[model samples]
Target: MSEVQFACSTEETHQVGKPQAPSFTGPFTTEGGLTAITLSSPSEMDQWIGEWIELAQQTEFCNAFYEPTFFQAAVKNLASQEDWQVVLIKEDAEDKLIGFFPFVRGRGPARLSELSLWKSKLSFLTSPLIRSGSEQQVFKLLLKHLRTMQPRVDLVELPMTLAEGRVHQELHRLIRDNLLTTYHYDHYSRAILTEGHDYDELLTENIGRHHFREYRRQLRRMNNLGQVEFRTNEDPEYGECWADWFLELELKSWKGEGGSALKQDPQQEEFFRELVTSRTRAGGVEMLGMFLDGEPVAMLCTLVSQKGCFEYKIAFDQEYKKYSPGMLVQLHKMQRFLESKRSPWVDSCAVPNHPMINRLWSERRSIEHMVVSLGRPWANIVLGAMPLLRSLKRTFRKPKR
Candidate 1:
């Protein structure tokens, strides 16, 4: 924990009706003779936010798959719905924005006497737009800034996705060196296109395979019960109808057996609805559906961004499981993805070790994990006890069948 200092300028009195404004003070000193400043106003933060994002995008580690705008929009959406803080870090020497960390107050009884906060939406995997300089120095500065606010935050859980990157690796190293308590959780799925040299060639290759013959045979069998057809929103006249059909099909599919995909939870539904509505306006949302007798049997919701189409979600009618409607729907979606001008790869986010994603997609990607702590002896003791605690908890649970 650090000390809190109150500083006041003549302007500060007008803003908060106080002679002084409270600011957290910490012991971590800046490198390169840089000073730390926190921006409290959103407009102030936005002033140099664009430049900060540009720096991150220009970094060698940047991936087009995670667009800056998407993250910015997501952060804004979360902040608008709740009381949260968005912090911006800049170099005092040049006043250059170096990092952005969005976080909110932690809700629950405080086990410790410290106020707690968490990264907004477990945003560890999403890098704070950092400039291309000494990453280690910048990261150290960022952690120092976080420590200053330790009185307001207890545990920092960053659910970093696709962790096999240098930035994440370095972060883990720092955390371990400092002896912080950290846990790694398996987050999402990644899949690669196994059938093509390029997008068009891959579609052609898939269609020419013996599996395509079997697909057609199954389609013929499904059609006998009614009419089996693949529908997409590429056409203007059919676009809105297809979108609605996709949503309905997703609700009725296996996902619906437990609960409707989007409608399963109100919050998830809200997130998807907002995502689809907003992204569709930008010509990003691509909805695909498999219809039987004009009723959708399976549906997939995807987003085309940069050079890839993301298979965001997919579901199929449980009754049509024997007919493999889910597989049929994916084949149709992949075919459309290959033919589109978007990009050459389709990202099948994350799936369990199921036959669909594991057996079908040959390309593989690894997600990494790291633990961070504040280099305290007590912190190390608590972290050390976690594995033993987990083992004891597991011992008490009944074995699964």
Candidate 2:
């Protein structure tokens, strides 16, 4: 575990990562005087850290994954290749950064060369970093550049992004205006906790009386096991310790036997540690744990951006499964979200129709996968057929009933 050298502060400063001089020279500048620079390494982002941090602060749509602190850890530890491209869009008039997009030319559906948005295993959001007031201009310039690239990017796919966010709305607007060609698929809703709902009333309304009684019964059983307590770690000095505990606790569960825990992969462990250490002082990351007699039985890792929270990951010791320690911790977390002065809403970041979260959080957030034609008619034709292809695939892939 790495010790974070910082003090807790309500406000975060852009003084992250060591400074490095701009290594790439002669970036491609669009005719509209917007400079688009693509770097092959996340470390190259050091030169524009200030602008990138500022853009994250003023982004039109909030994506905790796109934030510099999270991006650095994800790219450095999780990226599979050096070919990943970090595209930064800057306006020439005022020399201000308007957008940040990470891309990679990879094999997409049909094994076609696709300029796909780069996202790691745990990143659930793909909304690009676009300056708040400059979304329109940024999108226009970005799409135009993508359309006219030298090698000719015929396909660009955003694997995961908010379905109804401002960025998605702009994509729709551009498509309706005949400025772009695109295809959307895999649209689904995930569980979310929304504001203004009393947690007790929500439970009374959503959970069946008998089911709620059983849950309470399980909680009472756990209380009988030992001194049960729910606690959260926000102190910078203990962030690394909390992260370590989370990893160990997760490994004591089925995830470990299945080789799916963070400790199962060294790189994944490193990423989690660095992310916690980096964001500890800024208060962008937190760990909530359910402890029995001072031993953790369940844990949750969360990412905070602006006022909203993303429940990024959760794990529980299987030894405590009978008492449902995982769900119990979530119950406490849900209560905290509702009663805390912070934002009332939280994105579970769980898979669609997740058994546990869907039952607990009645609200939903729409997300989708989108592909752009990038001004290629042939690609547009293929893109148009994707939904049908997907439908057929699903029909054939379903298990025989």
Candidate 3:
């Protein structure tokens, strides 16, 4: 095999007005008699990434779940705080960009070289930018790169969209077949708005059944307390106050409970703070507070984009739990969305099956996982053993329906 060297100068490679041009030039012949190439800069990979997303839209699992700008923003934010690297892969002769993976350096209590540098923030869902016909091939190519790059990473954590079945399943199969070390975390959930074929029709369908009756019931019940109202400030100037109040409610809700919000990690807090400010500027942040007797009892912070409204955060006074203030706040938010006709869907975000989400939204969303490793003998042995370990662990537990 012939070897070539490519320089790693960012400014020289990422010149203005040529976003699609390759930064570095190299070549490799694959076992399938295919050639592989690499691009060095994120901007250079944009054209192919855009094409992949367009093709991804036609796939069955496609949803407005991931916006390119959101990913870009997240990448920028994560990169700012940590040592990270972005890898772009392409098929050799075809000149088609196949995948992009943004990874960070591994740090923390876990042993170094035992895991891949993973993202601390939960924003980017790992979906490959692959053409329909080349999904498996593209994934295999990415695995080859990851394996070659593994010494720099430890464990790899790629969260797949549950709706995208093939990639995740293929990844699992590959891990077992190759014998790689793996762990699975079933965290996060989403609520999908369903009811109509179109946005307006969906809202119409939700009116009496979802929004009206429930919201009216809550209002009537709270009316005896004095007054119940939902409020929002669209002006950007009000964002800081909104964030402060929302954070207070969130922290209070988890005051005694051992939950994520109670951890009070500065990094996560900074991420949220930046997220609120940035999204607000883009008109993507919607802060909704519910007032009972003219006092705030519950609040929700939703992210609004062209795709839909995401229920990112919600909290209600524990004292008001008897009245189901959280549920009441959600209903009002949904009703407000319906009234404004601003967005087509409202995602409950990723959470396990909760009663509120299951009862309110008719549509279901999924979370996916992917494992990519270098096809090394040792890696294969470890990865291949995971299924057996899982089976053995399951055998010791009580059976469930």
Candidate 4:
């Protein structure tokens, strides 16, 4: 731990019972002469985290998973002790913070660890939380520092970063122009939407109006079974209740039976509860539900940050499968987004060519498992095998219907 003071928007706060890292204040110099600090404890920046998130949101490259709340959840429920590290990319000439990157080093494909950005299997759409315009510069310095830094990191592994995002794009460019030792692990597509003038207009332009009309007709028929109603939690007071409803609803679906639902996993459930509770107060979480005669039938959980909204989980009663309650709720949710204009965009984190969301969100955002191996002796082994592994994965995937 190092000792230093930062001129941040919020003064440091120490919360009892909350996890705390030893006070560490060390000045690290980037090869470019930029100042930064790396801390093992996330609590070190608790006071400044809120302001950091606010600033990150202003940039076009904000990632919800890299937010402090997400990191806190990961540290408490997902990661074991000594698995994660927070590196603060300091502002060039000031005591303030410019960017924050939280990375967890783990073994790569070759059973060797050079990759530090691999946190857990839970995080999707991975990327460093770098200052928007400094992605290239920061990595250059960090990679250089890694060569001599106490814990030798061999590579920065970002497995599922959106191809179009500035983080991925800039890093890709670094490989191209700077001759960095980077490798392409895999490339795949996902559904993403860029909100346009009106939701109606976008729907009409994307999914034909006639087809959308048919979905509405199906919903009207579902009304015959019961009084179909769509609802979302807009009040923090009802967050716990809504979360309970969602978890219970999820239990009635295949996910629970298969032991994959959040409630089925104690750690994951706690992670969601703790993180979503905070996000709800910050207006960054939404619990959308569909009801039948006042009874919950289906629900969708969404997490929002300044960057965009991500549809985290969707669940519905299998008894209402014929009514397509889940898909119906999905449409209603999109309609609500259109009406409320709450988010500028939404990411349906579905796999490529998903049966439902892919058709709805016509806009495609490609994502890839990208690895930048350090120029170490064994690094080339991981780099060389990535393309072959990607091909095998593609070959084994179920063919699109």
Q: Pick the candidate with the highest TM-score.
A: 2
Clashes of 1: 6
Query: For every model shown, what is its TM-score relative to the native structure?
Result: 0.69, 0.88, 0.66, 0.84
lDDT of each: 0.56, 0.79, 0.57, 0.72
Evaluated at residue 253, the lDDT of candidate 2 is 90
Q: What are the per-residue Cα lDDT tens digits for candidate 3 across 334-356? A: 65776677666677775667767
Q: Per-residue lDDT of 61-116 in model 4, one digit per residue for the tens?
A: 55677777776776789776665556776654433455676666676667766546
Q: Pairing residues by index, what is the TM-score of model 4?
A: 0.84
lDDT of prediction 1 = 0.56
Write down the worst ten-residue block by lDDT for model 4.
2-11
Best model number under lDDT: 2
What lDDT score is found at residue 236 in candidate 3? 84
How far residue 258's Cα lies from its native spot in candidate 4, in Å, is 2.0
lDDT (Cα) of model 4: 0.72
Q: Per-residue CA lDDT of candidate 2, range 1-401, in tens?
A: 11112222212332456343233443354647776665666777877788788788786557889888898889888987656666778876666678898888776666656888888987998888888766677777777666545455678888898887677787777777765567876789999897788877898788877777888899899989989888888578898899899999999999998999999999999999999888887889878999999999999889987657899989999988888888988888888888874864689999987999898888898999888776566676787788889889988996989
The candidate with the higher lDDT, 1 or 4, is 4
lDDT of 4 at 360: 78
Rank all candidate structures by their lDDT, best first, as comma-separated numbers: 2, 4, 3, 1
Query: Model 4 Cα displacement at 338 (Å)?
Result: 2.6
